[model samples]
Target chain A: MHVFYQPDNKKHFLETDEAHHCIKVLRARPGDELVVTDGRGGVSKGTIVSINPKRVEYQVRDFYQVPLPDYRIHMAICPTRKAERNEWMVEKMTELGVHKIQFVISEHTHRETMKRVLNPERLIRVALSAMKQSQQFHLPEFAYFLNLDTYLGQVEAKERYIAYVASEDIPRHLIQQLSPVRPVEILIGPEGDFSTAEIEAAQAADFKPVSLGDTRLRTETAAVVACHSAVLAQIQ
Target chain B: MHVFYQPDNKKHFLETDEAHHCIKVLRARPGDELVVTDGRGGVSKGTIVSINPKRVEYQVRDFYQVPLPDYRIHMAICPTRKAERNEWMVEKMTELGVHKIQFVISEHTHRETMKRVLNPERLIRVALSAMKQSQQFHLPEFAYFLNLDTYLGQVEAKERYIAYVASEDIPRHLIQQLSPVRPVEILIGPEGDFSTAEIEAAQAADFKPVSLGDTRLRTETAAVVACHSAVLAQIQ
Candidate 1:
């Protein structure tokens, strides 16, 4: 069954936006069954009861409340202007099962400011689309924008890591290094990378330096890789 | 310094195509120093000797032959139609240090008749570009198109594996399961995936089943992930 996303579940009726999509775009009609996810672990199975060009209604047949993962993997990264790169990262990371995404501004980040065109809503939509496509139950939280230092200080993960290409002797053990005792917050820098002072500041705040691999990965690719590495470590 | 590819070292001269790029596009002048790689293990430092638009020449200043990695990772993947997707996979897998790339035709592969348009040359160029960008010493071997079962049966690797999403009893240990073999071959299917019979045939040919991650990744993403996982395992 095709699944739709409706974050708000107050009305017990499909909103006009999703309704038009179901009726007009998908040609969904009365008696057709589909699933709707509330983006908060609530999934509802519904059969279309009313269908119109403007509005479509469905009656709930069954519901399942799936619990979110215990470990929250929050990746705070600098956004790349190329929408496709950022979109690719979002899709792949969602499939890898990240708990949240926070786009932040760093000292050497390429794009200082964006039009907020691809806001949290659109990112959440992408996450939902990937989630449904990948048969995943949880949806990651999305945030608009934040400064690196400010966001870093706000996050309260039991274990924090900063993934960077360091010339020094960093911990090579990816799986064993990360502590699975609590949630993880991993900060991935942009192409120019985190400045020296930024790295020092993070280290001062107890963020361990972890290596993804030997290769020099793009900002978006590194983010996805780090997210996957963390997920694999925790699950293992 | 701008780098250009010269696949044939015996010529000891830049080809007309690359000469045009060096003199016209890059505006390189005589006495300018740059690095050139033969896309093998040959790395050379050269100084521009002539700035002629048609036949620019570079005098070799110094040369170094880097040793290849102990372990060889060859990935035989079904090429995707979107050139960018295949190009991205080639670049990322090269950066992650893949040794060989073989484009194969699978049973359910969309592009059944491999067109000459999607040649391995472009993929090779992308890999070389990625190698130069990542400052890697050795360039991967580029293999031509091949049929699935025929190619799988011909290559004899110390260790061989196929990434299949459906197998439940497959080992989750990615790099840990493999022996420290010299050469490894990994087969990645197309977007539609290999048919059931194809999987059985591979199993019969002594290919072990391996899982990349828990998520259902796209073709290119899966290839890169497998490349990284296998390379990291060898490094460990």
Candidate 2:
């Protein structure tokens, strides 16, 4: 049985696209056993009742509910110009586990990104694929369409930090500062780094600036490191 | 002037390609100050002596000695078919700091990689670029061209770990297991993962199996996690 994602299945039916994949690509037929997830930590083992080119109906044989992790990640990163890297970030973080992602549009964000809009659909697709790949069911929500003020306004975290390279201040490394607290948000800047003014503003906004480590990491690498650090901090 | 890599500089002259970047791209002139690194913990600041189409001659003004971290990373990873990700592994690990990389051609290693030989120069080039990008001054040695017996025969590590997923025999997370010990080697397998026989052989050879958190990470992600964990564990 192949695994597929069907986030909402109150009707217990696979959509046309997924039905097409099951029937045509996977050669699935009626009475075949299938496993699917609802991306909200709900996985079900089902037997197909009927199938057509457009849809497949199934009856749930059993369901497994996964409890959410004790901690949540609210990773806010400025979009890099290379959408692929941003997609990679989404995929990897979703695999590692995250609750939400906010695309921070900053003044120093790559000029190349300014030429085009960030695609939320593509990020969702990447997230879904990674979720399936890692055998995780939770899909981290995107907060990209929101502006900085609205995004910050919506974040209700127990801990908040902004990752940036500090000069004389010498920000503490992220791992050193983590306390395994629930609901954490960490801001990662772009290639040129967050401007001094942006850092000050974030500081005023109560974002504690932290460094991932001694090495200067790329934006995507920093995001993943921060995400993993938060996850590890909560584990033990 | 712009920074460039000249790996073999015993003759004290930049090669044609680097010279082109220096003279043509950067328009560096005689008597101009320039920074170049030998990629082996040697960073030298020099003054241009002369330039030609073939090479740019420089006299070393000063040399910066980067102390090899009190630790070393002996990362042996099964190469994935996607060479881009392998290049990415080289770049990210180099940025984060590692002493060496070994390509373990294992039984479950992707068959596609077996068809094409590992490219050491390309890996080094990516490493050099990452070194400069991260402002590091050391290049990690590669052991892909060597036979496994000869490679493992030279093991001088204080600690050894094999990163893999286990079901019955629980494995400690890599971070929880690291002790800041010097000369640690961690093996990461391919997508198919190491076989039970291979695991047993490693266990017989004194390799402790370890997990990198709860997520089922990609081969590259696992290797990077192992690399970063080793580095962070070493940092006081």
Candidate 3:
């Protein structure tokens, strides 16, 4: 079944983007089966009733609910200087079932201040596209860019970690310390990494230091790896 | 120490791109020390000898060999329609220490045949840049695009897996079945996923079916997740 996004199906119609896609792009007509989501947990199985210019109307036949993931993975990371890389991370994280993304400005981040222009709408678009493509019922929440201090103060989860490059003396990789199926938050640093003071503060804030591996990963890669690793641990 | 790529460094000189970056961009002088790699296993600690228009000469003071990863991760994945996504995977797989990438033309793959245009050079450039940025000594190999049958026939590894979207009866996650520190080859399907015949054929060839997660992932996202999972399993 082709999954379409219609945040509100109360009127039994596809959203504007879905309408455009069904009518013009996909040529979906009456009697075609469609699986549509409200971008929450509501999934409806329906057949197109009409292909109107304004909206493709559908008759709901059935509905199913997909519960949220067993463990919530909230990932906050420093945005890279390259916007595409950050966007790519958002898309991949959505596919991997991340719950939330908060753009953090650590001491070593690319722009280092509020002066940088960040298009939150673009990130939202990327997340929505990825959620639909992955057949996921819910979209991950995207928070606007904020400083590390603000993010640290506001974030809440059962377990928190900061993924860092592991040197020889670094005792445990993230995999070694994980407790399965719990709400967790992971922080990924910029290319220059978290400064000593930042690390110390994170430590004080109850975030344990976890290592991804010996190889130095890019900010986005680290974020995705951390996300997947956390999910994999849940499965274990 | 800044890491630069001089794939050959044969004449005691940086490659043109590296030379320009080292001298023009980085402004290195005669006495400055530099760590450079030949994109193979050879890493050199050197001191600048001369600055010329075409190249920067450096005298090698010491050489260090970077052994390849304990477990070689040869990832064969179907390429997506978007070129940037494919390029992003190449860069990321490089950072994560994937040894090789083979673009397979799977049954469900988009542009399954001759219509697809793939640039191996662009991927190689991505790998080189990632290798330097990650401060890794070796560059991953980028293979030309090939058909799945040919890939199945030619690949030699101690272990093999095919990452698939799991349904109700899916038996195992990849992490559960892995033996530490063994070279492995993994295959990731396209956005449409592997055809039943393709999956059966792979199983016939002894490639274990593994699930990345419950949520469906994109071609590039699955590829990266598979690469990282294989590495993580090896870390076990």
TM-score of chain A of each: 0.89, 0.90, 0.93
Kindly list the per-residue Cα lDDT of model 3 for residues A1-236, writing each as its tens digit: 56888777576788677788888988998999998898888899989988888688889999888899778999988887777778888889998989999888888765634235357878888888889888899989878668788888987896999876533367578887888988899989887778888887887888888889878888888999999998898988
Residue A127: error of model 2 in Å?
Answer: 1.0
Most accurate candidate by DockQ: 3
Tell me which residue pairs clash in candidate 1. none
Candidate 3 chain B: 10-residue stretch with minimal lDDT: B109-118
Highest TM-score among the candidates is held by which one? 3
Model 1's TM-score against the true structure: 0.86
Deviation in Å, model 3, residue B46 alpha carbon? 0.9
Tens-place lDDT per residue, model 3, B168-200, is 478588888877788898988877777888888
Which model is ahead, 1 or 3, in terms of TM-score? Answer: 3
| lDDT, candidate 2, A1-236, per-residue tens | 25688878566888866778888888888899988999888999999999888888899999999888877889998877787778888887888888898887787764356336478877898888788777787889887644555566666885889987655788888888888757888989887887787888777788888878877788888998888888778765
Q: Any runs in candidate 3 off by more than 4 Å, and if so which?
A: A110-117, A165-171, B108-116, B165-168
* Each model's lDDT: 0.76, 0.79, 0.82
DockQ for the candidates, in order = 0.46, 0.62, 0.83
> B72, model 1: CA deviation in Å?
1.6
Candidate rank order under DockQ: 3, 2, 1
| Cα deviation of A106, candidate 3, in Å | 2.3
lDDT per residue as tens, model 2, B169-195: 678887888877578988887778877
